[model samples]
Target: DQLSKQQSEGDSVIKKLKEELAGEKQRTHQLEDDKMNIIKELTVQKEKLTHSEQALSDLQLTKQKLEDKVEDLVDQLSKSEKNNFDIQKENHELREHIRQNEEELSTVRSELTQSQTQGSSRNVKDDLLKERETQVQNLKQNLSEVEQLNEHLEQVAFDLRTENEELLEAYEEVRNQLEESVAGNKQISLEKTAMLEWEKAPLETELCRAEKRVLEEERKYEQTVQELSSACSPDTSALQLEQERLIQLNQEKDFEIAELKKSIEQMDTDHKRTKETLSSSLEEQKQLTQLINEKEICIVKLKEKSSELQKELDKCAQTLRKNETLRQTIEEKDRSLGSMKEENNHLQEELERLREQQSRVVPAPEPRTLDSTTELESELSQLHRIKGHLEEEIKHHQKMIEDQNQSKLQLLQSLQEQKKELDEFKYQHEQMSISHTRLFLEKDEEIKNL
Candidate 1:
């Protein structure tokens, strides 16, 4: 009976050992299933991390492009500000020029007012008219005097000419008389020479005969003296009578020589008187000619004075015409100045509009990064529903990426439109400034011409 009891206990122990082995096998299978699920979850996390990294890289590139666009816009804004400053400077210069023109216009208006006031006064006008009338009358009187003087000088010259002709005739007559007297004196001298020759021959013959007679008388007187000494008295009275006849003949010849000397002295006095009369007539003709020359010079000076007065009258007329033109130009300038003020107001409004537009432009936002710890916690909690949750998350991430891309594109379009508007505004502003400068230059040229 003890042997049978030991066999039963061995059987029970073997059965218990088999049951424990089966339990161990089932626990090993459960552990292996858990290990596989954890590995799959880990792989899904790695794929999500790679997608997120790609999205981050795309966001970085988009941010860099946005920063470059912002820098470009900033540079454009600075350039526009510089352009505005230059335009303002030009506008200031234009205003200064306008102010100077206005000052000039004011002065001109004052002068015009003074002239109008003077025109209204009857006393001033009458005085001016009287002065002009007096000047005209004086010029007329001067002209008449010059004409009368010229006539008087002509009459005097005529009388002098007539007197000169008469003197010339008298001189010719004296010259002819002198020539005739000289011819007569020459004939008389020739006749006297022939007569002297004839008288000399007879006197020499008579003298020779007288000397022979005297010699014969002397011999006869000696004979008579001898005869008287021998016998005296009767022939002495006859010799005395012969001596008295010879003395009477010598006295008659002396009377004829005295009469010839008196005729020669009378001829010399007549020739000297004729010469003095001819010289006095020539001196009178020279004096008359000098007087005529002085009268002609006085007439020429009077004519020159009349011409100078005429030139002064012409200058006064030209000045009056210039004053009329100046008044018309001042009126036109006032109208132009009014129009320029209106244009200046319009430009200031446009500048204000541009400043407001520049202030309205929007800026870019900051970028974000992935949070790894939060993603790991979320993955663990959704482990059983991982596939479904991953599908929904991927769709949501794609929608967010699409929305970000759309927003970036819209910003680019807006920037492009604003850049186009700015360029067009700059072109219009430049054209307006050019036209304003051209108008100002034209006004300046007109003023200079005036």
Candidate 2:
């Protein structure tokens, strides 16, 4: 709209200037000739201005597209952030499971300690046996629940890994799209610039040709005026009449010359304005080219980052495999612990049965032999040793559980750190994109304003 207004005002000024010229019979003939030439020159200048305007509009459109592309990238980054958040939540849940398992392990350790302390009491053997059997059953149930939860957690982890992979692929696609758009914009601008330059060259050449023709005609008219003056003599009324007409014609030529000078001055001004516009447009083109170059570099960086992320994904996948293997080892250890508890239960039953037998039997001469008593005593001693060995195994398993828990904690921490780093990189990418867009927009507006 603004461009049209400027064009309309230029037209109105040209009309007013045209109207100001004399319409005398002596003047109209040559004035029309000059006016026609000036109109052609004006049309040529208008064409240049139109080309500049078209270029400006094209740049504005490119700016709008870049902004839209940046906005889309921002949206994708946000989605990636959301996915990371979900993964963090999943990690937190896994941590919770670790904590619960740790607590259960501690409870089991304390119960085992209490049972060991009470082992010397013979009267409570039956109670001890019953308690051990019950505890073993509870332990088995807990292990089963833990194994189920671990399977669920593994599935969740797998799902998260797949999601991360999908997001990474999506980001790569977006990056490629952005790169292609930048390339397209660069190509389009180059082509338009070439076309405008090609088009302007021909128009300028034609304008120069017209100006030269007009100059040649003006020179011919001057020569004819001089010849007509020389033809006129003071002796006859016809000659005097012819002389006066020539004088009027000369005066009209003077007027036309003055208008020509003014029009030439206007042309010079318009030419300068056109040059400035072209120079500014060139500067904008340079900036756009630089922006495209920067975008290409950024795309390269994005590709590298994607490659790094893929590596990280592979590492995570590898870690998950290790975790699965470790989980199997831990489950196997739990099973061993369950079997040990069962063996301890059996041993406690035997000890209780021996205690009951001892409490009921009398040391009669024929029924109880000395060797049998010694054998029972030796068996009792063996059971005690086995109990001690089972306790040692339980302690070793507990230590292993503690170590596994620590490893898990470390793994979780490392994952969190990696996530933070990933977030930081994404944020930096967003910031750079925004800054680049803003700078390009500022420069674009500056060029157009110029």
Candidate 3:
């Protein structure tokens, strides 16, 4: 008996050890599976790290390119600033020259006015000279007339003396008339001489004033001419120097522009490389995320497996307890079987009756219930009709959407055509504007010639 018990105990221990070994083996398999998953995840991470490193390299290159571009831009800016300073200086000089020219122009205008005044004075002097010569000729003609009148008077007096023997009274009257006429002629000559002298004096004074004005104007004109000559003189050397400077500045600007263009090209290349790198990095990140998700799923499965293993262990323990209870019942079965048979038959009958009662208690399908069924059928028909209506409405909506899409497509096509037309119109307008400008220039030239 002792040996049997010992053997049984040893068997139990062996069974427990077997169960433990099985559990441990399952645990080891689970661990191996987890390890494989971890390895896969680590491999994915390594690939991602490699991708990131490549991306980082690309970013560093891009950063370097950007720094170079910034430096080039800064250099260009400095050059531009210098060019601006030079241009400002040139503008200042041009303004100063313009101011000087304006001052000179005002002086020239004053001289022109003075010259006009001098010409008027010279004309006045010439008129005075002509007037003086005409006055002298008139005086000579009057003297000759006086001489002829005197001769005629002497002849008449001699004739009257001979006739006085016959008519002394008539002769005396004629002699008195002749004497009065001679006196009147002398008075007129004296008045004419006095008037000529008075006119000559004022004319001489005016001539002197006009001559003085003419001399002053001549001097002013000479000064103006000298000033104009000086002002009109071109600073050819300075202009040439400025032109050369401008050319130099243009060359510098071109060089700067070239540098900027190179920098921009480099920047574009860097940006493209960076974009490629970023895309690769994103793909790697996506892969890493997928791996992480897979790992999470594996972990969940492992946990479920562990729980299932625990449940199996618990079921085995429950089955062992049930076996122990069944063994005890088997030992008691011989004493109770005969009495249990009668009770079992009675219980069977009761169980059947209970089953029948349960069946009766349950609701049964009835033909009169067909009224609710018909109502439900009507509701179903209504729902079907509603569904059909909705389907028809959906079809109508689909047709409307299709029509809208077609209209939108047509509108887009029209817009494209309109854009093309606009481009053509713009080109035509540009051409017209150019032609107009040319025509205007030609017209201007013609007007200048006319």
Q: Worst lDDT window (10 residues) for model 1? A: 364-373
Q: Identify the superior model by TM-score, candidate 2 or candidate 3.
A: 2
Best by TM-score: 2
Local distance difference test values of all predictions, in order: 0.38, 0.49, 0.40
Model 3 per-residue lDDT tens digits across residues 398-450: 34323433432343343244335334433543443344344334323322321
Poorly placed runs, candidate 2 (over 4 Å):
1-122, 233-362, 365-450
Q: What's the CA error at residue 433 for candidate 3, in Å?
A: 56
Collision pairs in model 1 = none
Off by over 4 Å in 1: 1-113, 118-123, 220-450
Q: TM-score for model 2?
A: 0.49
lDDT of 1 at 26: 52
Q: Which clashing pairs does model 3 show?
A: none
lDDT of 1 at 262: 41
